[model samples]
Target chain A: MVTAALKEDLPGAGREISIEAVSHRFDLEGAPLPVLDDVSFTIEPGSFVALLGPSGCGKSTLLRLIAGLDHPASGAIRVDGAQVGAPDPSRILVFQDPTLFPWRTVRANVALGLEAQGTLKTEGHRIDAAINLVGLQGFDKAYPHQLSGGMAQRVALARALVNQPNVLLLDEPLGKLDSLTRLAMQTELVRLWQQSGLTAVLVTHDVEEALYLAQRVIVFGPRPAQVVADLTVDLPYPRHRGHPRIAELRHEALRHLGLEASW
Target chain B: MASIELPLEAGRAPAPVQGWTLLAALPWFAAVAVLLLVPDLTYQPLGRELALIWGAVGGVLTLLGLFGNRLGRVGRWSALRGPWLFAIGAASVLWTVVTAKTGWLPQPFFPTPQAMLEVFLYDYGKILHSAAFSIWLLAKGFFFGAIAGFLIGVGMGWSRAVSYWATPLLRYIGPLPATAWLPLAFFIFPSSGSASVFLIAFSTAFPVAVLTWSGIAAVNRDYYEIARTLGASPLFLIVKVAIPSALPHVFVGLFMGLSTSFAVLVVAEMLGVEAGLGWYLQWAQGWAAYANMYAALFVMAAMCSGLITLLFRIRDRVLVWQKGVVRW
Candidate 1:
């Protein structure tokens, strides 16, 4: 049943996302705190891009704007040439915390997007396939509190992919995991993105993680963020961790974030 | 081989000691002995009744002590067995000595335990009828109050405009006791029964509304944002996300409301209602039927505790995830 749903391709599954001159600000105690400053970037369909920055650099805010969870103070976000005004199932955001509804079981949490769109009855098998895709087949009945941090994040990934979203906006989705689990999940993430062929924008503070996974790494400057550097990771799939190229890219990313590149 | 044997030994249950079990039964025996040896100073003829009750209690205690270890994981009662037995026996003996023998407390006001028991045996029909009526009124009031409170709470929490208008009204009216409006309620309603139900409902509604509103309002913003990105409709957000997340608080409200409703139920019933535990209490008080009043009070305590225990069980089932997160 799950295989059939996996084989069934969504219509316009890999639509491109374009953000043109998008800017956003927050009102902090009667003062306007600008977060994003005319941030413009275009992601081709099925590409994995990482938005790397220091803490409080507004990278997460950019992802939120693209997700249509919040609107930009100026400029617009478009998906496949259509202006984005509201949150849609076609683009789902995975947060730093798994944020799986505590009351729901693993299967129910994965089925949330389908249930929200009212297509759960027809696309029910997709939920199973997505859970299977994330390697959570035997944990369908388990509640969120029962899961480990890494397992919970996997469920979150399954929840986003179950919708077969054209673009998956991730905000440090694995930032809370231990080092070993984080490394394992990095591989799992790359595999899921490769299999689904969906565009992904990951926001993270980790330099090596960005270099290890994303096809293109876009570095942002400090608060009132703007794109400071854009580097292409030409390293082959399953890139060697100890490789000099990865180290070089890490140094470059660190330099962009105004940190001293020790190595 | 030695290591495996060590693990096996660790897994095995500790041997049950019989001495503690025997010691636990001693208190119950003492209670029965006290009942048999002591004579009643008052000419109430409560001697046989006290002996019967204490003997039955001792028999039950002895049985429990003998087989408690066989109950396995649920044998927690065995841990405190001796202390519990001693406490119950001491309390029973003290109560009997004071009320029936010594008569330290005066008659009529402090009736013997046997007098209360006689009320249970003879006047049970009346007591039972009154309990039924009270429970019926409670069910009606609670159902209406809970539903109305939940809906209004959801509305106030979800919408700024609703909160803006309703909060002030709630603030002004909610703190006032439910019984305070009894005079007005009696005049407006068609019957005393309706008025009693209204008072119970009104008392219950405030806490439920206030708590539910706060619970909904306090829901993590991340959940709403995440749900929104997943294309959840407004209705789905409320019914699925908001309500479920706020349930722990709703239960808190329900608990507070339940206690308040019970309080209001008694007061409301005392206001010329033809039948109910509260009305029975009033009637008993008028004729100085102290024994009957004690019986009714005991019944009321048991019923209220039973209702509370039932609510806790339901909360445990529905909010199962909150088991380790929040402690009652």
Candidate 2:
């Protein structure tokens, strides 16, 4: 029930998102190929949710719809009772590839959102703060090519964070990182979400990652994806990898994804 | 009260004197010797004067080879080996030609290098004036063409409608050589100078526009999407994302345009211009002043290379982030 003014003024001022019967399709050689089919979900303000599904299940597409980067073929996605039409700085989407502008330094890339909004002169300090928050200190002048995969992703995170968005849509943000960096970044992501107190919807195929970070997991079906299962983790902070309860939840999530509990 | 004494080594290894330095100096020494010992077989030449100048050049090279290590940091004397060889070869060939020993290539057509050098010394003022005028014309044409081409290219890239209309026209008109329009250009413009300028500009514009269009078009869609999500306006996306991303391609276009402009400049100047390197070349050719023509050619080569090097320097500064990613 947060008002638009309140959301605009405050950092991490969460906005309740209610997506009703949203569907999306892509045109492939003059053919309408269904991607998302009648997907309905509600994300509470300041909550962490994970959209878990198999590859090609339209999880990322759903996030795109909510971010207003694309319009749903049918139904509507609303943030705080207002229908989403176009992309806004209030909802930032971080993609799998860092997608950082190669010509700009890390500092300049992080300042993009502010610069676009013409608020860089006033809120310039936030760029440095966001870089610091992402643990990318002392890399202000580093170019994208100079960075490691994890560091580049951290810069991408900082770029999104500098806007102080109410919702952060993550599409496999750490998918390209190595196992060790992935494990570390998972913890970092959780800490960032907790500190910011903003609604987060992460689209991941990793069952363990979903269980480790998100409070709610929305499993999606194959192709014309619809909600298969909606489960709550209800786990405590700093959740152990080998915890019996987490292991059981992992099995459940895998079952919903139509995969054997291989792990 | 007492000075501490350090033990001295019984044997010390001698610092290696670079042998390549001596190898580089041998050719220059030979060149100087040839110039001095060999008498000119031609009637109109002074071999002694040529020998003195070459002897000075050879002496300098020998000095560089001998004391190059003392130059500190700039002590890479081995790098000069190739240039040293080239100079020797060129000098020997020129000595043979001017000496008329072979009688294979006669004068008026193939003048001696010294004769060309004499032209440089005698007519330097005229050469300088022509060079200055050519540079001014080149600058005006290049800037105007580059600016116009960039604008048109950006528009074509940003809008489908603009691309739809302009793309076909560009394809049709872009490939035609700038020289082909000479007859029409002469009549359309008020003066030949302006027409020449227009021709230079026209030659430069096509490649720049075409490359820019492609550069902008080739930019990844993900960038536009990301920029849009971050609240970038259409203008912001075009300026910040599209332009910066397409800069590498724009530079490619600029390089192409620059080279073509030079070609067009020479042709344009030759046609009707009163002063320029190309004009000087035409005038020299008309009067059978082959030495002056060769001198002007040398000037044109140096100027073109200097300008290209300047462009590369600008590219390096502006595209600093693309350091190791893209190399010349």
Candidate 3:
């Protein structure tokens, strides 16, 4: 399995990323609607964190800011130690949709990140191995159209994994899946994280999903969003859904999120 | 919720192989058998020609049928995807055969299909040279015109300022068909072939430009945003993303432009060009050599069919995503 250390190490030695007073705004009512006001956070090296929030909160926007897919209206965003300006291959972002290029088959799509890096011909077998790691071995030649929603998303995950990003950012990556597939993908993602050592930060409205996957969950309140709560998951690897502590923590997280209990 | 592995070989289903040559030879065997058994069926001029043409047609159909494993390989067969050249070839032969039997159509008096085939085989060196000239004219007209139009269209589409300034002016000129430019071209151009080339270029450029512009306009906003987010250079976006994404639409323009250029060349050739399929067609018609006229018509049909077939094949191979097919 490839590791993120292969990327150029960000200077200032220890810091993985830092967001300093970053804020985002949009024009609403012909005036500024502060979606994220003075939002400040820091992600430590090799951390598995989740940004949790209710709908319409700027959780996804925060993730995008760190990935440099969007600029903060104010203040600085840094990856490692340097300021964020644009998306770098070293910080891969996976969206809710698979976003696999439809013209390419699954293997080709999975290999594309490496292909873009001009390393595929020298490391093509590595791509195959990554796909195999994601349990998508048989789907190597299948077109995106031919795969199920779950399978296609797995290919997207494989594509991201193949890049060996220092920071793996996901924007509700499992929100579009059926319940069973979402559960399966969450497990697969955790497994991938342990094996590949990706510093993952996922943003989602699903409190349970956030709690289930992350080492630490950070919940943000509605617009002008800021971290309202942070909780550590002390459960071991392959945590069971039926565990009493898991349920209690999930309910507690949801309650703080102001969402009615659905489970 | 454990990650699961699927069997690597589960999805593949092997395709059946077929023998097309054997299938084509079946009709030949049948025709030979009929000729041997019935002398009455074998001893006529029209019968000989029908047998020859039928052998060719049957050969093609048998090839398709025998290679049934490959015939309907994938995708739907709508009008846009039909085998137009094959239809044209079959139509040409059918017209010849029907005209021969009924004498209903104004007739050609020169040598028949058998004669042309023999001429094609023995005097091919000379025929090939003439074919080369005709091909050159076709190429010159198509390439220069299509390229000019594509570039102009891409420019117009990419730049709103250019489109705003140039659209009305071009629209005014585009309606005037290339052939209509022939009279003006006659006085201005130094030679007949050059004039034909200019006419074809002007004719083809308009649609190419129009198609290119529309193709540019059709680019999704998301793609641009994606490129920008990736920090792609302006050159990279235009060369890599914009051009490829616009290709399907540009090809439509090119195919139509090519067909139009060829058609226009026929009328253009009649002006003063001494050689070409169109020139030969007129030569035969002037002498009332209806058989030669028919033969030339057959050749022209073959050329057009060949061109369209070639373009479709190239398009299919290159634009695998587009999945264009030849129907009928």
Candidate 4:
């Protein structure tokens, strides 16, 4: 579904997004419009990638295709060497809102994905383990209304993780948080990712956050967004906020987007 | 410097057993005392037999109240609480016993306690049978109406086609009072007793249906969304989310429906049936047996209070999770 949306945005010709074929027309059309005219990328298993672009750019559209939430009108798409069609448990998507079931307790909400997959006979064990994983111990019976923003989102993370998905798709999951909570969540997310060895793809406009967490940051241009640059941050785990190499990479990525680089 | 001492558990006062117990008995004891004085003080054609019986019952209760238990005790055997209830019960008996003794009070007035107790003791077997019969009718109407209304209301709310087609007809038919359908029910059913039950059942069902539909519609949209996103099947969504979510409102409907059914059953029995409490009251009123009419009326009041209490207990038990949880 995501690939199809990306392909539809590509407009003019059926060229792969990274290749240069800006203008081509269907039968009687006179003008050729470019919206992601050509774009291509490959993501390795067990890798964390951030697709950062300005608003109205097709970066989100691209991630949707990769998540198998949408189909490409014309493009090749594969995950783990198999074609992506429908939403599978292997590729789980988490949205910005926690979307926890209000009626269910925190433990029940966290165990929901597993329940859907019919693996809920072990629900008792899984729920406690997941709640502990997200540092939400002693809150198993708390309702969603009783939780803080960060805590509620932790339940959502636990929900996604309980599915045991190979690929974790985050569509601006922390975009709605206050700055303090967002920073805390980012640190938590990185720690969880490191411990779990889960492959993650985050779609965010927060370039600093992107540079901080992801190993590879793919920059997309303004409109008809294609990969404008690919910068690799080779910082060690538990990266320092004021590291010179991190600052340089942020500057380079911002330079590509025509923005000042200083934090 | 003197050590300042604060009493632990300050302002945690003890329960007022004596006060409540005294308040409870005062009304009944006063009524009985008034009845006992009536024959000697008044020149009315007061029934001598009735006054004697009521005075005896009152004396027994006053004695129990005086010596049965302590004023400050809280248990059932405690003097204060037990006397208050005893006084009230004794007073009710005194009023029924004295109804025939006084012409100052209108016809159908409560008899003096003695007269009511005599009638109760002599005909207790018949009274119990008829009271039991009426209660059975009420239970049947309440259960049938509530269940039918709830299930159909859920159907109407859940299905657009059903709501569009059925609601208009229900609205039209529901407005016509259940009493209005009695003549038809009597004609269709083989017996008047069955007809009264049907009328009560049908009348009770309408409010239940309306309430159930409204309750189901009131469930949060987010619940449905979560269920859908979680890939819940249609059956799971309805049974797990929709029904439980709608239950609180549905219970209100059930209570209302049960009350309506009980009230309608009395009317139905008074009009057509000959065996229920309603019939007994009607029978006594027609014969100018004012004392029996009062007795039956008292029985009916007791039944209504008991049924309402029972329904409330059930509601409390079912919605126990909602205790202390505030919702708008």
Candidate 5:
């Protein structure tokens, strides 16, 4: 009951994101290696979208660009008609590695965004709320080393949610978790995004995960990555993994990722 | 071993002290008997005092064996050091026999333990004064140097311009011994005290600076990105993310600096300072007062170890999270 009331008071408001002709590259030694090539998409406000691609296909890079942690080499990413120039608290990125500051306890790690925003003094209560939201109620003082992979990622989620970001850019956030934790976190992710009323863009290679969690799964091609397929998961909430529609989507999604989908 | 038994339940009586545990008092009692019954060939000061100390140790160990269960942490600890107490008591008795009672060894050079004990009894005032000076000097130099090194390391780590300039300077200066600059130090500084401080600081700064720089540089790039996306400013990124991430390395640098500071402290005091453990050792050695020199050496050992222990305690407290993480 306490958690329910606290969740309602938590801060977040979904916002629209527009990526137009976005491209990015990295220099290895000397030559330029293009990663994202003219990738463009629009994410409606409060919608859950999963960017499914093969490993190293630049879906994660796209998430980084959306979060404004890094800029695309060319083209504009706008949030509500404002050119995204730098990272803002409104769009928080949860990294694949959790990247929780090892020195900080769970409470301190969750408090980071607010602490940086200078809102910690007034909104310290949000930290406890977010921790409870992640089901880490009794682990506020636990260090990262003391946590399992799933729990650490939960703390990472709590950390990002505490700031109440409008767009949660997950760069394969659950990609490293064990299978069971991965499934559990996938469910929790949908619940968290829906409850927070925030737009979420998850970059993952897991086709089933993409279909299971997101409203729409956008597939990408390899290397200088380009859009390969755009899919809308028409299934209802509490979608079954063994559902006939999910299997069809998985086959189609794998085909787009250059897999045979033999099974 | 008895005390290291499987822990008793809360409010339960502690495991009964073993027979061997009670035997810890045997060596001390033997030492007391040897001191009282053995006739000394040479006059050794503090013979009675030595016997009394051993008698007290034997008495205490006996009491601990009988009633240690009722006591708390201290009692448990003393019980655990049963072997250590026996070894120490036997070693003392052996040393006294070989050096003073038989007069088997050369005189003056191998003064009995009591002769060294006499230094503590009579010359404690001057010796403590020297120890105090050493502590003050070490604290000043190590404190200033460590602070400066930490700042420089952070600068070098965070800013390219600072790193570009500081790297060359650090590479050139960090490896060279701080005492190598003694000539310049003495000439430039206004007083011997300042010169000593500078030398010790120089010794401490190199390791701290190098380590801090490496720590900052090795920080995970994702850490910075995570902080930035959370609406952290550049200042916050450096202070909250980069610094904490690099802390394990910084502590390593601090440790290296602390030990080197001790070496540099002694060298500086011997060369320049009017008072300090090194100066006391040098002064006593000049007068052929080997006992006094040995006493000062003991004091120096205790001081260095004490400071090192303190640093380790701080590192443990500050980097408690780092304990089970990585190589830390």
Candidate 6:
């Protein structure tokens, strides 16, 4: 039984991700504005990694690329040796804004991916499990407008979880929540990542958040983003907030982000 | 006593009795007295019937004022609402004195209350037929126009090629009123009824198409991105994402289209229909049967208002999620 539990905790559920020399740009008033600067990184299967960066550093853009919502201008992104051509149910992105369909109830919003995959009939119970996982059991019938900001984000996360995706690409998913909610959600994120056994890539500007949750925090520089530092948090899950290692890593991340770390 | 005095206060009490309820019956009694005492200057056929109606209203109001507190909140509210009933009674008495009791306002132009009543009683069948015919024509044209507009709007919204083709044509033709299409429409269609339908549909289709287009265009790009990353197909994006997001705008379009259809329907009916409220109005005017025209106009107003209310009811039900967020 102990062996079986250990096996379940292994990386069997998550797929490996590789980004080889990926670059992307946006057309701003007819001028090509580079966002991702030939950035390349590999994420190990079932690892919780945070893409820590200042705002507009293209970390969110990278998350989108990994989700296969947008194609990189150059280079390739592969999941377990297969290059992703388009969005697949195996990968999902939860945006900063919950972006819940305002017309849909919480349950209906969570059911979106299953509905898209035509698997709702068989896997319908996943919607309930997802809602419960996010601690939004009683709000299943509530509309997006009725929800508080943190609850709406929870619904968004639940929406991503319902798909049972191998990789969860969260693009600053807790960026809009209040500081207290953000801190609470940071712990929730770690618990969820451990429970699901999926590869989690969180893009966040909050250095402390990265340190608190991710097993590895990959710090990024300003626009046309390139990797500046990748500090692995060697601590285990249920990390102490007052850990000295977290303070050191946060200072290191802040220095790379060009911010004066007062703390 | 304080509870009765401050009955209208929020959450004070569900049922509140007002002493003014009994006073509401007074004006109706006054109108009835005037109907009996006043001398008729013209031959008003339904004066007795009018008096009976007034007497009945007064009797009902008196009964409601006396015992409506026992019927709970809705009843108590109605019983307390007596000023409007008084106003109606006062207006009737004044109208009788001016038109039937005296020759202050000339006949055929300003008919008496009894003359209006005569038209209602005697010409009920013909008016009902015209009203029914108008409704059928309105429904057909509105349904077809709404469906066509919705399709065009969705097509234009989702496809670059369709938008490219439709935009120029819409700009050129959409601004022109349906009356401008009248002569051409009649010339093309075999029957004037079909021609009228075309006009109503044409008027309705424009607003619905434009609003639907704007609605779809205004959708947040983040919504599309969210759906896409969740494994939605291109078709699923349009139908599930684009359509539902655009429904509020579509309803706005439908409402605008519906009102415009009423105007076009009247114009279309006046131009060629054998029977309709509009045709009946024109016919009554031609024959100097002013009373019939008045009755027709009243029916037309009631029908239009009723249809609008029905649309609002449907909108409320369908867009229940938008209750506090968007107010039409």
Task: Give Cα distance to truth, residue A143, candidate 3, Å.
Answer: 3.2
Per-residue lDDT of model 5, residues B36-90, tens digit only: 7988767778878878888898988888887776777767777778888878888
Worst 10 contiguous positions by lDDT, candidate 5 chain A: A3-12
| Reference-based lDDT, residue A255, model 4 | 88
Please tell me which model should have the higher TM-score, number 4 or number 6. 6
In the range A160-219, model 4's lDDT, one tens digit per residue, is: 766656677788889989999999889888876765566788889998899888988989
Instruction: Give model 2's docking category.
Output: high
lDDT per residue, candidate 2, A66-122, as tens digits?
999889999999999999999999999999999999999999999999999999999
Candidate 1, A109-148: lDDT as tens digits: 9999899889999989888788888899899999998899
How many Å off is the CA of B145 in candidate 1?
A: 1.3
Residue A136's C-alpha lDDT in candidate 1?
A: 92
Please write out the lDDT profile of model 3 over residues B106-167, one tens digit for every residue.
43453444445544455456445555677788889888998999888888977788898889
Q: Chain A of model 6, TM-score against the native? A: 0.93
C-alpha lDDT of all candidate models, in order: 0.86, 0.85, 0.71, 0.70, 0.87, 0.86
Name the candidate that leads on lDDT.
5
Q: How would you order the candidates by lDDT, starting with the best?
A: 5, 6, 1, 2, 3, 4
TM-score of chain B of 4: 0.78
Best by DockQ: 5
| Model 5 interface CAPRI class | high
How well does model 4 score by local distance difference test?
A: 0.70
| TM values, all candidates | 0.92, 0.92, 0.74, 0.71, 0.95, 0.94
Candidate with the larger lDDT of 1 and 2:
1
Q: Give candidate 1 misplaced runs (Cα > 4 Å).
A: A1-12, A260-263, B1-39, B66-82
Tens digit of lDDT per residue, candidate 4, span B1-328?
Answer: 1233346634555343334444455545555455555453233333455445545655555554454444333343544245557566665645544453454455445444444555676767777778999998878777778888888888987999989987998999987888888878989999987787777778878988998899889887656544544555667667777887788888888877777777788888888887888888888778876667778888888888898888889888776545545462
Which model, 2 or 3, shows the larger TM-score? 2
By how many angstroms RMSD does model 1 differ from the true structure? 3.5
